[model samples]
Every structure is written in structure tokens, then in C-alpha cells.
Target: MTHILLVDDEPHIIGLLERALRADGLEPVSAEDGESALQLLDERDIALVVLDVGLPGIDGFDVLRRIRAGGSTVPVIMLTARSGTADTVEALDAGASDYVPKPFVVAELLARIRSRLRESAGASTVLTYDGVTLDMLARRATVEGHDIDLSAREFALAEQFLRHPGEVLTRETLLKQVWELDFDPGSNVVDVYVRYLRGKVGASRIATVRGEGYRWEA
Candidate 1:
């Protein structure tokens, strides 16, 4: 079972998260504050950390910095009441894997946690298919000895396709996995971006299935 470490100040919040994580078949260990969270870091098997930013004793960011300074690459998802862009950027700069604003929906939080943990799994995610390669770690893609630069959204879309190479990806699945939301099929955004990606990754790398969606080629 994936082990998740949850740190928050509110007892109710901890209880809620624990229940949700447990229901998902994950073992959740929690801390009431940053100090205790830092202490719990001594455990080596924690796969991911969901940390609340406004804790007493050591602040979340402070604890995060200490965690990174010790060279721990454990993925952290920061939960903060501050929804400002600066706050998000600051947490990302401090080595947070992702950020979720408080008053979060349980479903959205679960999705975010899943994505962060996959990214933290690093070595296991170097997806490859046919002659193309995607190194999620280096945020780089290559095909037939050529390197390509992909926009963040494009890269995420490509990542999805790579994971299911040779399989048709329904529009809804692509939208949910890449944008985390449903978008109108009439919207050209996905098509336009896929065109851009195909141009770089190889003209025939991604194939359109008419009204269905797309598929990664063999």
C-alpha cells in the first residue's frame, strides 16, 4: 500500500483526510503540526507528504526547506489557505511537488495527490514507445535522436498518450488527465496543441482517430 504522510493543524481535517486516504487503500500517517511532521520524517517508507502551510512551531515552508536541505526528494503537496500566485510559486520554488488551495474538494485533492506521487516515483515513469522517449524527470522528450521543447500543458498531454501508446485515448480521458477538467469537444485548444506537439515530436507521432481522439503510434 502507498504510504501518505498528512500534516495539518486541525483535528477534523486530519480525520477527514485519513478516512479518505484509507478508503483509497493508502496508509495515512498524520501530524498535527510542522514540528511533529519533521519528526515523523525519520521514517523511511513514507511515499508522499500532504502538508498544510499554516502550522504552529515550524511553519510549513520552514519544515519544507529543512526537508529539502537534508536532500530528501520526497514529494510534497502543500495545502495553503493563501491562493495567491506568489504563494504557489514560492512553494514550488521551495521544492513542493504541487499546491492545493484550502477549502479543497476531496476528489480534486485525491487527484492532485495521485499526480504528485506518480511524479515522485521518478525512475518508474520514464515512459517510452516506438522510437520516442519521454523523460518526465528531465522534462524532456526525444525521438529519433532529436530533442524537443514542449509547453507544460503539451508535455502533460504527451505524457498521457505515451502511457497508452497504440491505444486510442478518448477525448474525455485526455481532458481529465491533462487539464483535470471537462472541456467542450468543439474547442480547438486540444487539437491545436496536439498539432504543435506532433510537429515537434514527429509529424506522425500522434494520430487522430477522426471523431474519437488520438493515439500514440507504434
Candidate 2:
């Protein structure tokens, strides 16, 4: 009964994905362009989005920015023909929950989708460590009494740290838990987002492990 929004211009791609998603017991809602995709997001209770980067107007990046700016924390898995690392990093940096390059295997994509949905469904409503607080249901984070604006990725990373305070969360663990990535993507994305989180939640809260990873400290 989970509804997934599919945003892509190509009819064949949508058709293929639609069939696959239906077979997986998920409902598929299709949009051929970014505008429609945005509108659908506004009008429907979409659980997740499968967004294609090359839209006719208001490309995938822009659409993602808009989604975040609107304060929607719905999980988004971006699909793009560009297989470059730059694009992958850019999509992640832009707040995508996951990225899939074109010509992807259906099984892998389905696994990613299931992973994200499970993460979403299993989250606790609120987590507070020291003065930092995360409202998982609202997808909002606050430090002390002030609100902190966090992108989807930042919020997820913060959630992981708070859930296991004082635990040494290695980069690989973070990559898997926060980014739903099983292998290292050979990017400094984890470090980059950690810096971003520190800026908002105070630097002393997350300690660097020198050679290992990071730990949330009181």
C-alpha cells in the first residue's frame, strides 16, 4: 500500500519501473516532468520518490532542492544516466537519500528502496542527547531551543549518531546505516556531512576517532 512517486520523462523507463514496483507490492505514481512531480508531491501522500535527473524543466537537482526547501523529508532515490562520481556526490550533497545510475539492475534498486522504507518505518519519534533533539516524525532537528535546518542526509546522519551515543561509529557503518550504501563510495561525503552536523549541533558533541570514525559524546 506504499505509494512511490516515479518522476521520469522517458515512457519506457517509467513503464519498466512501474511494472517492477507493482510486482514488489508498491503502488506507482508517474510524472513525466519535474513540475508534475512537484505537484504530485504536494497533492499526494507519497512515501518515497524515484526521481530521474534529466527532466524537461526544473531538473532533478532543482526538484530535490525544492523538496528540501519545502521541509519535506520524504526519502528520494535519484536516477541519472550520468555514472560519474561527481554526479553521485552532487546528488548526495543535494539531499538525495540514494542514487542509482541508469541501466541499473532492478533488484539492486528494489533493495535500496526497501532499505530506505524500513529505515523510515522503524525510526523513533524523538531523540534527545544533551541539548540536541531530533523529531523523527516531523523530520526536524533542534539544538538547545533553536531550530537547526538539516538536509535529508544530515538529518539521517545525526539520527544515527544520537541513537548510539558513545559508540564509535566507523565510516563504513555510517555509510551503510545513514546512506544505505553497503560499500565505500570512495567519497568524503560522510566527513563532509559530519562537519555540517557539527556546525549546527556544536563541535564538541561529535569526536573524531583519528583513524576509525566518530563518536557522540555528552
TM-scores for all candidates: the values are 0.59, 0.85
- Residue 154 C-alpha lDDT in model 1: 77
Instruction: List candidate 2 stretches off by more than 4 Å.
Output: 136-139, 148-156, 175-200
Task: For each candidate in the order shown, give its overall lDDT on alpha carbons.
Answer: 0.81, 0.90
Q: Which residue pairs show backbone clashes in model 2?
A: none
lDDT of 2 by residue, 1-218 (tens): 89999999999989998999999999999999999999999999999999999999799999998898787778899999987778887888787888999989998999999998997788677999899999876778899879999877888899999999999999999987776666665878799999999998989999999989999995
TM-score attained by model 1:
0.59
lDDT of 1 by residue, 1-218 (tens): 89899999999999999999998888999998887887888854789999999999888999898887675768888899887767875776576777788899998998888877776665455778877787765667888758877765777788888878889987878766665445676767677878888888877878899989899886
RMSD of each: 5.9, 2.8
Q: Against the hidden true structure, what lDDT does model 2 obtain? A: 0.90
